[model samples]
Target chain A: MKKIKLKVPATVANLVCGFDILGMAVHDPYDEMEFRLLETPEIIIKHIDAFGLPEEPSGNVAGIVLLKIQEYFNLKNGFEVIIRKHIKPGSGLGSSAASAAGAAFGANVLLGNKLSKEEMIYFAMFGEELASGVRHADNIAPCIYGGITLVKSTHPIDIVSLNSPDLFVTAVHPQVEVKTSDARQILKKNITLKSAVEQWGNIAGLVAGIQKNDFPLIGRSLNDVIIEPIRSILIPKFDEIKAKSLQLGALGGGISGSGPSIFMLSEQKETAEKIAEMMKSVYTEIEIESFVYVSKINPSGIQIVEEV
Target chain B: MKKIKLKVPATVANLVCGFDILGMAVHDPYDEMEFRLLETPEIIIKHIDAFGLPEEPSGNVAGIVLLKIQEYFNLKNGFEVIIRKHIKPGSGLGSSAASAAGAAFGANVLLGNKLSKEEMIYFAMFGEELASGVRHADNIAPCIYGGITLVKSTHPIDIVSLNSPDLFVTAVHPQVEVKTSDARQILKKNITLKSAVEQWGNIAGLVAGIQKNDFPLIGRSLNDVIIEPIRSILIPKFDEIKAKSLQLGALGGGISGSGPSIFMLSEQKETAEKIAEMMKSVYTEIEIESFVYVSKINPSGIQIVEEV
Candidate 1:
């Protein structure tokens, strides 16, 4: 089998009120992939040391995804794969989604494009389900297509591409890990009717804001009462970082996903970099080491870097 | 207060997946009013017929609404009022909202245009809060100013008037009573996460439908998974009415508010009337006496019919 290389961008899910429903892709943070065609009818995966992936392809996140797709198509091609990770894992920046989506995208291209974008999202979600124990496309859809993407529904993965201009995104990954399982476990099974009303109002407003290109409305709508309150407790100085980011001229920012990282959206590139610096300062004051990424909205998801 | 005549249209709240947020007014089944100037300094009320209204002006639904406005603005004028009920009281057709909004509109004219539409709605909602034990403006806003309205936030009554064309509405009121409290009590405290996602998807589609004036999309969006399931059980032959209405070319219909009434929307006025007849026939087959009304969208809400 021959080798192939692919690149997948980092993504952010749960964009404020869009909890479990919306996601977007970032340009700077990415993961690299190497795929090799094999002689036998078996798939094998190897992590290129940087990604810290599991050895067996079937056990590895990206490898299991490829195996499921191959099984679905009953393909007999054997392959060896390697992944090089740049996006930090557990940063709430969709590092796992980048790997899973990148693998699925690369494999589908290698298989002569048998699936549509919607089909790719469906297949990619199987990889997400493997990682999180539940099928979710909020992160995968955006990682696949980039920019503002709405997982309008999960049953069929109705991905609606929103008209979001290329804006700067500032993200801070603190030296902490908040497991998605632990973060999800803390959410109340039944939200109060009061909170549900507020959440839906914000969700509607956020959708309108994005469509109308109203930044302040977007900032105001980027508020979550149900999940963030419970999840923010897992990340230290979450409130301080958010406050400093806003103080530094960010429209608004919050926990990226189930996170120890925080991200902010800014209309200008300078504001995004400034917000990133402010976030770093706040984390330093709290005695926590952090990595900052200043990027733009990625309109394309996974792409071929070079031919095999 | 000089004698004045006003009419307020009936409103439908919780339009399908909107739950507590969306409402609209129809031209038929409205409440009539005759306001009179009083010599006495105290408010007085009289019921011309068996409308089951309070005799005391301050205690009557309409009178209470006016009194609140008077108190808020420190007005000393007294008024005599009489209301003619046309919309049935317990058919979930916003009967209370009609009376409250009608009184507020009438009094605003009597006081020489002292309040804005926003203020009038705020006063009218106070009357509704007395009846429902909660403040909601979905019905009241439409009763004041018609067309498709979204009660984006209820605390301050942020009303967003959506761009919608004149829609034909067919409504059927089954001769029965379903207490709002009983209907509300039947809903599940916790819904599956899956249902919530579907609910929001429908809402997004519904909003787009209203904005785009797409009748088919509107009909498709008129699906309720949260409130209607529980509330419709209290409406006899509810399923048959919905089925027949759809079969008769009505776009879609569901239980209006907390119900003994069901309503459907159609693109043509003739079809609306046809749907209404179909509903009436279905109720007759079930041996349940019912009343049907076919009307178009009410663009302007409560208005002065005659001035002294």
Candidate 2:
């Protein structure tokens, strides 16, 4: 059977100070999925890897995404998806989002690109809700739109794609799981107005810096005043990693989405690679197995590898 | 002695959802100041209008600003400034910032533009500290920059000038007083994390909208969920003005700086003029004394109105 092959890139959500609003896509650790159209109206799911994720359409992230796409488009044909997982499911690096966004995008493209990026994001959010307790577009928006995205409002689904500068990203995914719900449960329900103001200032500065292409401004604005102070306790060597990354000339970074993983932004590929080496050295010293990737910000979100 | 003629435009701080961070300049209601260089180091201050402002070198907003500038530059020459006031103090129209920024900028020009915008903003903040019990740069930055500005951090004085779009502004200054200190005192010191997230989303969206030049996106992101709800109560007819202005094709608007004055943005000059007329008619019917002005976004900030 002829199949559609897809490469869906991973993403870093809650970019530094922009909690729940800003996200960016990365080039490495893409999930390669293969899919084929069925003559009969029966959706089939298969896994080509040992990730041991669910194959049931209702329970699987990619499965539920395709089901919704099928229902929305009202297609008589069904999809047979063969998955290969690379991004860990709970690495705080948008694993489930890749699967969900990949499924919706692949289906839409196969159906002659019927839906807009906004529509695809909307449908993919269901799968995200199933993975995490809340329906957030921070990760999904970047995964679908590519580059950096601002989720202005999810209720009305307003997503803005910002201009991506020529910057490199270095990410480390330690083999520790931090369920998004658990990570969210630890946060305080209220913050002091002073802290809130500081956070808003940083986020505003970060957005303006990106638009103006001010590298130093971007670095200065990446400090998180609220979320990181609390969430960093969950990851081992979090403080050391961040301090070392900055000392190694990283612009700034923080917990990618919810938490076991960390990401840093850099102006050059060499700096990004150096940060990766630092991450590996620290993790090795701590006797923890981790995966590190140095790549540029992904300008294109999901790609079609080939149709076989 | 040849005099320096300058026009410093009024600014709208807390531009909708961006309280304490984002600000923009308007062309109308500017304070015109005349400065002449003195032979010895003796700063003389004068106000030509019936604004009942203090003229003492230490107690005056313009006086304190000039003193600091003279001290910083160690200039042997003093400035004799005669100010003509139009923007009213306690009108939520950045009146104090106009004077402060005007003094610093005028002195810098007299000193051959010796200081950068950052240094000028720093000197102007002392005057802001005297007017309101806190040091803030939101108003001073835009007054000096002549466009939209983002005060990223005030401690180190980081300000960024955003690209100003071709938008018209209509301002209504109702003759009532809302002190900056009082306006600040009424706000809650703590805000819900949920509301803060919403606010950050809106601010990020607003900055992106300005950079992308998306009019409708700008309109959509102008909703303020925090400060306006508390401070708007201090302004009479605040809710009505906002509703009617939006109905009149204004993107959105709120209390300009704190209270008593409201500003709305429109795409067309005729719409801005119409908003001005509506404001006048509404204030007239309410038996409230008012002043209205329709102008465009002052992209040049403070102008040298013929440096003699």
Candidate 3:
């Protein structure tokens, strides 16, 4: 094996009532990983971009995942990994997941496609656990499989691929840091039984809405009663952005994953772009700098962009 | 209007993980209510069967609903209601819901059809609250509309009719009682975050499965971690009955509403009958007598058995 280049898409998890359970892939933002075979006895990692990644193999998210994969397969040859960061870190767009998933996927392809896609997802999730302190497959599965993905069960890595039509997603990443640990800590340990029932009902409806391509039903079902109420307080102007996006005929929108960013779904590209502009203007009025990405739903997960 | 007779089918609520939320209608095991237009300005109530129902207008479930409806419309004409109870009470089969919905629906038709279906459901749910001490529309909506029903929001009573295909249902009503209030009291106010996520995933799958008529997916999605674990203990031989029914080719089975009665579902009628026999045998070994009802999915809710 000589060299391999891989592209991994960003993911958004916990779409409304689907707390810690649902996720989907986006197209515009992605991360790139390059793998080179080395004759040296030990593994080495080099960061080519200023994402503030670690230089050593053990500390880096991608490097740690690669070490696990090699140990699992008992590989003797060493490899040098280089990560080129494209998606910004801590934007609630799954930056670390892309890195971990991209590294595992790139290594699998360079090593004669040794592991299956599911196996690669498991390995990438292992890497994500080190970064986030929890082995969640919601972000990693969508980053690997693309489109709208449901994490049915995490332990055995059971994933269900949903049928999503050609839809556009508009995301606005505000330049504010809300740590995942802090965001998670604010959530209440106990929820009202009534709210729990309502959440599950909406989740069921959202799943059916996605499968049927019923946009209105999807919009009606994209509601959160438990997690969003607490987590949205972390994002500035979150309620206003969500209300304005719905008012603009963008179907539904909410805080992406843990926040500092918000996303909305629209049926047309023009509407999606309009939503992006609307979100940008709201953040601008608040005097907060933000970056907007208008992209279509990516059906393809991790793929080889180039080879040497 | 001279006289009319209406029959409303039995309903099963809280389909596993969908506790206090989801419900479905079945074909057999229904309650019959007959209404006669009285020439006088006084309402009369009569219970002709041995289902242990109160005959007084205030204490009777159907008569109380009729009184509320009369108060809402402020009508001078009176009605004579006769309820023929076929579905046994204390069976966790929504038997009370059938009588309440049937009376409301029958009176609505008898009084020149003054209310819409949605309004009728609202009035019927009030009757359910009178019996259960909580205003819930899970059983009333399915009894009124038939098929699988989702009560999206109950404040103004918004109901979403789900598309559920022909499912074979086999139910065993054991000679035991499990109070609705007792079954509800045993549930923990706070659930584990992990179980909550799993429950939502299964609910999403169950919604998709019903929409697509995917039996395998429906079978897999019928798992419940929140309510069933505590409620199932109230029913004797519940675990063995569920296991035997599944082994006999049931897609899934659980306590219909509370306990003492177990229900199983299959794709074919023959398999449903077999599951019913298996469930019966399980209860018979414990010296408990049970009655089995094998029925198909009912699409039409309350129907006129005989018109004026």
Candidate 4:
């Protein structure tokens, strides 16, 4: 292909008790990318939306992934990638993952789909490592594979995309940033064995709920006894947003990733819409510009927007 | 009915990463109980097996469960319960849960099946409390509900029986005692958050594996980063047994509940039997009398042998 355009979905990671293990994709507020083959042996990147993201091939998230793919595949051809950023950066909505995954996915299409999805994730993780100094794929896996994904092991990078339930998601980003590093530092290195047992039970229940499509069970299992208690402090009015959303018939939700954004799930579209409205109230009260999305889980993580 | 006879299967608790939450029942080894209605306002208990277990209604595990049921149902009529213990005590095979579950199950049949399985578990937990000084129901839930049970919550006692796969189980009781209290005392009160994350991932994967009936997934997901690391030390030749079981085509296995007994799961009956033979070799080399059982998961937790 001479040129390819890709739409990459936003992902919410650290799903309650599934810290660093689970993530889910949402359809709305995605990142779009355009890639074109160039005649010169040079990689170029540009951001259509102004977010002050690094555009240098060595420093940019998407550029880094593209360079990794090119180097790993021994591709001498040059490429130019333009990104249209919609999922806000540092919103804890997997903005970096979208860029990273889009770069690898689009580049793979040009490479005749030589790499597997897992390999693409392996390459994209360099972008995450560039941003966070950690090669974690909880967000990238779901962004690339779509729906719910579990990073079973990171060393061998075993990731499995789980069956998705037909449910609606509501996300609210309150125009604030909770630096991932600060959130990481706040958490205790150790947790009580009691809490860990309870947390694993919820994780198991949550997986069973998703597989069986038991929405109420999913709601009941959305508990994070370990991380939420510490990290929710980073999100403004976190309690109010969660309580209101749940009260409005949202199945359940918590701080998205490490916060500033909160997401909830509902079985019905109307309930999801209502939950979004309720979540927005917290940002409104705080007088912050917030972004709200009510959408179904995107089953296809990255799809071809247009072909050459 | 004037008399009710019940057989409650043996249960394996603390299923790898599902510590204090998951359990499964096996049909081969069980405890049988016969409960007869008497015209007095007292409860009588007798042990047909030579275990020297308490025959009093307050001290015996089965009698305690029967008393609790009678008190809850406000039944003035007395019950004479005869216990035939087959699952050896302190073998880490949930011998107490079998007795407790058998009592509650038998009494419920006499009460015209008024109690739901969950309620039966709630009452049976008292028997566990009487035996262990704790009200945990990891074993009780599976002994009462069969299949694979997850005690997701304990306060309100929310328990779910997951779908059972067509897998074979091999168990070995090495004729040694690993006190549950000792096994528990060795565990640290806290675990590193990193280990907990890995543990919860395995748990989520295990639940998914059982739901999807994916044997390889089940085998892959049977890791215990937290509990087994410490608890396996209590079992003799623990590492060798587990390594050999896996090498012999057993999907996965670990310390049954705490120690002394080990269990392995296999995709076929022949593999399960082979796993049992391999496990027996360890005890035979050490000159220990070990009992081996190769069986499928008991879909029905408790069944009535006869009714009068």
Per-candidate TM equals 0.84, 0.98, 0.89, 0.98
lDDT per residue, candidate 1, B1-308, as tens digits?
Answer: 48899888998887777787888898889988898755555666666656676767556778788788778867667777777888888879998898888878888888888888888888988778777777788789888878867777766657766654668888889898788888877877767655665666676657656665667767776887777877888888888778877887888879887788898988888889888888888889889899998888788877788888
Candidate 2 CAPRI assessment class: high
True contacts reproduced, candidate 3: 0.59
Candidate 2 off by > 4 Å: none
Q: Considering every candidate listed, which one attains the maximal lDDT?
A: 2
lDDT tens digits, residues B114-232, model 2?
89999999999999988886789989999999889999888788888898978999999998888888888999999999999999999998998898888888888898999999999
Model 4 lDDT tens row, A193-242: 98998898899889988888888889999998889989998888888888
| Docking verdict class for candidate 1 | acceptable
lDDT of each: 0.79, 0.89, 0.84, 0.88
Off by over 4 Å in 3: A1-7, A33-48, A55-57, A71-83, A106-117, A165-167, A267-271, A303-308, B1-5, B35-45, B56-58, B71-81, B108-115, B268-270, B304-308
Instruction: State model 1's lDDT.
Output: 0.79
Evaluated on CA atoms against the true complex, candidate 2 attains a DockQ of 0.89
Q: What i-RMS does every model get?
A: 2.5, 0.7, 1.6, 0.7
C-alpha lDDT of candidate 4 relative to the true structure: 0.88
Q: Tell me how far the alpha carbon of residue A182 in candidate 4 is from the true structure, in angstroms, after superposition.
A: 0.6
Question: Where is model 2 chain A poorest over a 10-residue stretch in terms of lDDT?
Answer: A175-184
Please compute DockQ, using alpha carbons, for every candidate against the native two-chain complex.
0.27, 0.89, 0.53, 0.87
